[model samples]
Target: MFNITQWSLKHWLAAALLVFFALFPLSGDLFYTSLLNRMIVMAIAVASLNLILGYGGMISLGHAAFIGIGAYSVGIPAYYDIYNGWLHLALALIGCGLFAFVTGAISLRTRGVHFIMITMAFSQMAFFAFVSIEEYGGDDGLVVNGRSEFFPFGDIENNVTLYYVSFIVLVAVLYLVYRLVNSRFGGVIQGAKANERRMRAIGHNTYKYQLTCYVISGMMCGLAGALMANFSNFISPDMMGWVRSGELIFMVILGGSGTLFGPLFGTGLYLLLEEFLSRSALYTFVTENIAFLNDAQPWVYWQLPFGILLILVVLYARGGVDGFLSRWGSKNG
Candidate 1:
């Protein structure tokens, strides 16, 4: 029943990757599974960011604020013993949608750097607001009493189950985004992104389209936030901090903007590099062999190599890793 001819190389690769991930837990390592869960959740968030930034040409530095709101929606409710997973998810989506609708309405009026600054300001305001909430652990963050309940399916307490759920969600989000980007509405959004004046001249309400895209992106990120809270069993103001927002943007840019799978690759590569450098064998060797650096904190310097890699990617790989790979494959073919 399946037609292989209908699928592209990228689709095949995606299938293979999914199969690999599905069987990844056979290794019996919960740590790796947990890490992959985080990656999946983050991939969703980064993809949501890409929808607005890469395709819609809207740079929202406060995007993580929506994520935080989603997270806290779960955390705050759970703190009061409201353990319904579906309810938490609904609250997250609604809360994030309303916030994005209000903020996007205002932010869409600005362009370029002003949009970025306003988003950042909103995010900071959210971070501080969460910090000032005394009952929810304040600056220390809130620990979830238990994982979300899925009723008949039950809680996602098992690492493997959580990983699979997150993976399925990621796949769904990717497919949704792919469909959206290829749709007539998506064309209008992209056209507006390319040239708002032309789109406006053609009778397209650029503001409405952009705000709709923004709300959609925010809701997607909010879903990711719910998963994040479930993944860590903790929620904090730090989840929505400016630094996290910046990291999400970096993942989008590093993975190749406007490409559906780029964010996944970017998030995986960035997180993996961060993990590797933090406990790198090179760091160990340097600390052991170099006398002067023996007492130094090698982990502090882990970002140096990542920074260099980023610079190289930006300078040489114009379209990020995904674009570079596509070009390389085409050239070789």
Candidate 2:
């Protein structure tokens, strides 16, 4: 039995968020619900990346490749008419873990810009591999005709049901990460991140620790990928693109890399801004008010504002939104 007496404000806030998410579906707006579902999935993916980039001090620009692997794990099996949810998820976790093990073995040997370039190269290789799979729609992508079967629970076709499932997984992952970061192994990895030379001098096998962390992160992201495939009911090579990897990195940084809930905040904020900018009335206003802009799509420039926001976050909130909030809280307290 877990004791509730030791729970702090952070724990309470997490509970409140879960409660809010649980009830959000009652609003009955399918569009918003769908957006929230994507946000939850992206939150998991970004958090997994944060595990390596923030805690382990490993920079991987190919993280999305593992996600793409996971997506294909589901898509490929389902292409053969296999639709078991458990099986798809297991395949995703195992496949991504193996891929991470191999890639991490090679990539972890390098550091700095070389490491970044190597990861990006691996990701590009993965992207090309997926594109070469002509039977699976190749560059066009594959559509899942039906949702994965969960036996007693059935398939997750219901938007509300899917939302709850995603929310539960997100909460579980957050808790798992929180516990992992406080464990002895986590301490060793964090120490290695701070100074690998010192860790090695003290008898720690820094490479092994980092590799283990990388694999764990990959598996976690793989799970997110499985969820994403189900959520979108599609898988494409684009999922493995370097652009997606960059977005994941940005989400982790924007949310405050080292914080447990930072990735969630960052994912939600980034996606929300993207959605708003792409669909907002401001785009219509710009096209209507400016004659020269009428011929071009105004929404295409949504990145302009998003890029500006990113710059502002980097300049002022170096620790990300989470860090800024923490500072504000401490100051007021």
Best by lDDT: 1
Over 4 Å off, model 1: 1-10, 287-298
Ten-residue segment with the worst summed lDDT in candidate 2?
Answer: 6-15
Candidate 1 residue-wise lDDT, 1-333, digit = tens: 037866555545556766777788888888888888888899999999999999999998999998899999889989998889999989999999999999899999999999999999888988999999999999999999887888988988777788888889898898889999999889988999899999989999889988999999999999999999989998899999999999999999988888887888789889998888778887677777989877877776767778888899889988786788777766755
TM-scores of the models, in the order given:
0.94, 0.94
RMSD (Å) per prediction: 2.0, 2.1
lDDT, residue 191, model 2: 93
Task: Score candidate 1 by lDDT.
Answer: 0.88
Q: So what's the TM-score on candidate 2? A: 0.94
Write down the lDDT of every candidate, Cα atoms only. Answer: 0.88, 0.87
Stretches off by above 4 angstroms in model 2 are: 1-15
Note the residue pairs that clash in candidate 2: none
Candidate 2 lDDT tens digits, 1-333: 036776544445556666777788999999988999899999999989999998888989999998899998889989999999889989999999998999999999999899899999999999999999999999999998776788878888787888888888888888888888899889987998899899999899999989999999999999899888889999999999999999999999999997887887789889989998777787667767888877886666778778998999989998887787777756755
